[model samples]
Target: MSVDVRWLGHSTVTVDVRTPGGSLRVVTDPVLRPGLAHLRRRPATPDPAAWAGCDLALVSHLHHDHLDLPSLRRMRPTVLVTPPGSSDWVRWRLRRPATHVVEVAVGQTRELPTPCGPVQVTALPAHHAGHRTGSGFSRAPRGAEAVEHLLRVPGAFPGRDLDDLLLWAIGDTGEFAGSDAVLAAAGRAPDVALVPVGGWGHTLGPHHLDPRQAAELVARVRPGVSVPVHWGTLHPVALGATMGDRFVEPGRRFVREASRLGVAGAVQLPVGGSLSV
Candidate 1:
């Protein structure tokens, strides 16, 4: 099996998992918005169509960046996998029903039969939160519902939602309830593991994973190769720093510590570059 992992800055990654016949590509949290809040836009823009041929799309959680409906709709993958409570959001944003989105709660594993073969995906526990809130809202009770309905209008959802929904992940700061569970439910190891190592602030959160925490997870999950993400994409709201500076270091940190910790197979790929593993 060969896996091509591309780092489109931050947590967005395009994993092209290959078998003997063809390839099964999996995209993780792709963002294409610019000048969001404090963080500046990525210097380069990655074409979503590059992933147009992907077999499956993985929305880790409901942060705008991860579950951006606009970017999601543009890809048009055969299958969509996300955490619980995400179906409504994805379906609503994509102007589709919940049935179109595959709901995978933490610790749930599903086998997607792709042209290459069976692509196994396990929904692991992430320390994150998802909410749909825009600046404008009236006092009416159903105002939120009305906005949701508009998003759900057929063909109204575009690839732009990926940026509108600012997905915020609280890093691994506190005791995790499902950290061990994610490792356990995975059963056997995966060919490629995409882990987050940056956050919205300088100080990491209990739910989010810093470089060190990501390294530890890498050791635990023991994937063939680990790609660190969730950094360098968006600027920290609190710190007022660029996404590139904040996230670039942690990936290097993960490499050094993982190597020092004797955890092998730690590699970093350039944004828009490809890796065969």
Candidate 2:
């Protein structure tokens, strides 16, 4: 079996998990607009049809860049998974109750049914905080908990080191002390990992992973394929072309750093690009 992973800029990813039984498409953090706040997407916004038929969508957190309501409403996957404490804002703002939204907590597993087979989703711990100004009554869900995700199919890929076709989407986060145990929840390395390597502004700072840290994560997770995301797609408009390495270098830098760390499978996908593994 093989899976196609597409990096749709920032933390947004479309994973097409294919198996003999069937195919399941999972999209993460759908921020599909051209611009938001001080940031502007450098890549073309994906057509809604590109993701409209996804089996499941994962929301890492409620920051505007990750959980754009307009983008979600446009794609409208069969089911949506998010960290706990996100329902209220979606219910109030999204206003699309017809969309099946499941609130999953860390360590909890939920089975998502598709036409082909059942896909298991497990929320993992992340080390990011959602800041709020005035209760999030205006925009974004400030109280939502951010999380990483481990997606698996019971028997998709055959003749691999792992029986199940496991993939991990490591959303926006920085290194934390107990992260080894957190990553150990899945018991083993995933077949594929979509990791954030940079932020939209000057630096990723301590709350997010820069290229070097992202490479370190690859050293730890040791996934079969480490696909870099969250870089080379968005930039701060004020700086114009002056952002230089911060805006345009994380993906390649992460690959290089990972290689230096002996992680041979680290790779990069241009925004809107997909790779099968």
Tell me the tens digit of each residue's lDDT in model 1 across 1-277: 4445677766667766544555566666656555443555544667765576756666655555555666666667677776565565466557644224776654455556666655555554444444434413311111111000000011111343321111112212223554545334434454456666766556676656777877876676566676766666565455544334664687788888788778887886666666765
Judge candidate 1 at residue 151 and give its lDDT. 6
Tens digits of lDDT, candidate 2, 102-136: 87788898887875688788888888875433454
lDDT of each: 0.55, 0.79
Candidate 2 stretches with Cα past 4 Å from truth are 131-135, 139-142, 159-161
In candidate 2, position 244 carries an lDDT of 78
TM-score of 1: 0.75
CA displacement after TM-score superposition, residue 170 of candidate 1 (Å): 13
Per-candidate clash tally: 22, 0
Model 2: per-residue Cα lDDT at residue 189: 74
lDDT for position 44 in model 1: 69
